[model samples]
Target: MATPRSRGPELEHDVGRTPSLGYEPAGSYGSVRYLEHGFPNPLVRWHYHEEYELHLIVATRGKVFVGDYIGQFEPGHLVLTGPRLPHNWISTDVPEPGVALRDMVLQFGDAPLRQAAALIPELAEALPLLERARHGVEFFGLSEAARERFGRVRAAHGLQRLAEFATLLDLLVRCNDYRLLSTVQLQSFDDDAALAHISGIVDYLIEHYSESFSMAELAQRSGMTESSFSRNFRRATGNSYTDFVNHLRINKACQLLMETDRYITNVCYDVGFNNVANFNRRFLQIKGMTPKEFRRQAEARFGSAA
Candidate 1:
């Protein structure tokens, strides 16, 4: 395995043929495939699936977008995405066009998983792992043993499958080198429109965060009435339109403050907040400190390192 590097630059990958929302590949997955990869734009745009997915990104440094939280991903990073959660692993830096970014995708035969999960035993402990997978859990505890085991995931398959799966889950259930993406609402694949609509709104905010916008514009993006879009958006993301936009601005502000040497008021206007007082209040509210304090803390942590 390659030594993990620091995060840098914009992500880029091929946007290829997407998996169907209803896609469930046939096979006795429990005693089945240990590793497989053939998705055209595998690391590209967001797509949902019914089968449980265990993605082991070896060597390829990327960003795993489970829901709203986005951050650094490195080698030996294991993510178990529950059925139907829209996900995409964007390369933090562009890779060779023809030589695709490498990742081991372990897709479970949901049939066996559901069946095995129902039987009561010490295995019941694994249910918590499955339940947490609902919000797309990411492993942060990458040990040399478990890390090396993941490096083989793209090569293993058949008879030895169940045993290895148990091992993987054991590592996941026991490891502290991970953070639950968050305790988020679980809608699953049952609601497709809401899922697509929420992402559409996120894209809009990303594109126009600095510009003034209206609820009606967001509605137009989702092709729904303002009230309808607002309700669905809030329901899907656990944040209202106005509040969500504010959160995005504050998050961006926090990043700029932490990462750059920009002025406080300049950072404010840069992330969409106009009023200095409003920016200070929102930044303090979300970050538990004023902009100056936040910068001071960041400097305190990184200054000595530099």
Candidate 2:
């Protein structure tokens, strides 16, 4: 269990149509590329690439940002992000010397797999998993196995590496303890300008969820009328303006409840809710539990720092 910190200026720059990283692996490995990198490196940033990424965190706990999804991640946090999906992981509890091996990644293009799936029925089994990855997928109870498979993939070459990669995919495809992370599929956005605007707004709201504001104010700031903003916002985030804001506030309340020793009423107000009843209602609606219940469960699972 990891605690979250406020987004800093570095994180603000990471929002909105993030810079794309060019990954052209040249080797005998063919379609699949395996990579491992440490923290505090240039490669660790808010970025996107054209290939699907199977990411496994091997060390350190932090907050993970994928599209509009914000959550805590620790070692053994496994996620698969689809092509062009923006993502970043920021570690808040770094030692003075920093971690040397924080991530293990496998990158591959969909075109090769889809093309092969047309010829090989066995490969086609992975198509749905890739499709679900468009919104990002987090796999649970597979970290140790995934780490072993990743090692096998990294050690093999040519068709052998491809086979190892397919085996890893097979494991993920069959796993039922997985959750889709992002509510909206960013690739579904046809308008680049609208995507950028909505992304910026989302970043602002994530950072300032405790502050009070209205959709009308945000609409005006974006230079769009209320009606136009409403339509575009829903299209971009898959939630109405009010629902989106409430989601952010509830998410923050969850973090507070898990990591801090605050009263339920104080936690509610701290996360922008004016009333305890409304906060409790939204918490149950979004998280499927009351704040007190959530705190108790989190403490039992992770042993609260407070």
Candidate 3:
């Protein structure tokens, strides 16, 4: 994957706070808000908010960062991230004019759903799915349907919009072919400064995973002591510095293995591992399969030629 260019000037100015894009139409849609934006827009960045986001990639293919999990995404890639889980998608391939509609997003709060579930037992069925989304849930084979449902919700108002939103949730709740992207569920932090600090570090790691760096260097950069950095990092991301880096590298390796016919050894080195043996060991530990096995399985599952 090619390195993503700078995120432009808007992101540099507002990296941590959520963009106030006139969320949730008044007197109608209630808690759920529908939003769609193209690439190179100000809304695209490494940030978090107190809303569960159902995000669908309608255009472009590139790296997606959700917490410490880094992976490739193409058109139809659909994921739901729970409240306050930092995430971003950087498209590596874009035409000069850029994509007109790169993302379809539905943002909703958890409390409203929980309260509704309390009064309406049937609505409680979605609780498990919402809990799973806290770690970032990627639903497979639901992109087309999700896009249509999002449109219906977007076009409707008041009760009609709420019903359409619930319909989309119902489909997601039934999907079994899904994976939790992040290994650990991030704990909420009371300190906004600390949250922003950890989020900035995560963005740096995702963008520069191939480059070499150490916890000491990161601590120095953050102006925190080495031990303090480690503790806060673990608290915010739910992974030790080493483990988080490994997860990021392994995820990138999986993307390459599935998309390219590169040699396993080369793929290993390309994803920042130094040796084949160590790479194989770590791959097995994380993926429960060898890189060769992973490639073969991916081809078999996707019906793609090796």
* Candidate 2 colliding pairs: none
lDDT of 1 by residue, 1-306 (tens): 223233222232113222332122344343434443322343345556666777776655655555434446776677888876656665544455532435666666556765766784767667767877877887775545555665454345564555666777678788766655633342334468877887777777777888898989879878899888887887776778887778778767766765567778888888887799999998777656788876664432211211
Q: Is candidate 1 or candidate 3 better by TM-score?
A: 3
TM-scores of all predicted structures = 0.49, 0.57, 0.58
Question: What pairs collide in candidate 3?
Answer: none
Top model number, lDDT: 3
Q: Give me the displacement of residue 197 in model 1, in angstroms.
A: 32
**In model 2, which regions exceed 4 Å deviation?**
1-25, 184-306
**How accurate locally is residue 2 in candidate 1, as Cα lDDT from 0 to 100?**
26
Candidate 1 ranges beyond 4 A from true positions? 1-43, 95-101, 109-111, 151-157, 183-306
| Candidate 2: C-alpha RMSD after superposition | 10.7
Candidate 3 vs. true structure, TM-score: 0.58
Best by TM-score: 3
Over the full model, what C-alpha lDDT does candidate 1 score relative to the true structure?
Answer: 0.63
Q: Weakest 10 consecutive residues, lDDT, candidate 1?
A: 8-17
What TM-score would you give candidate 1 relative to the actual structure? Answer: 0.49
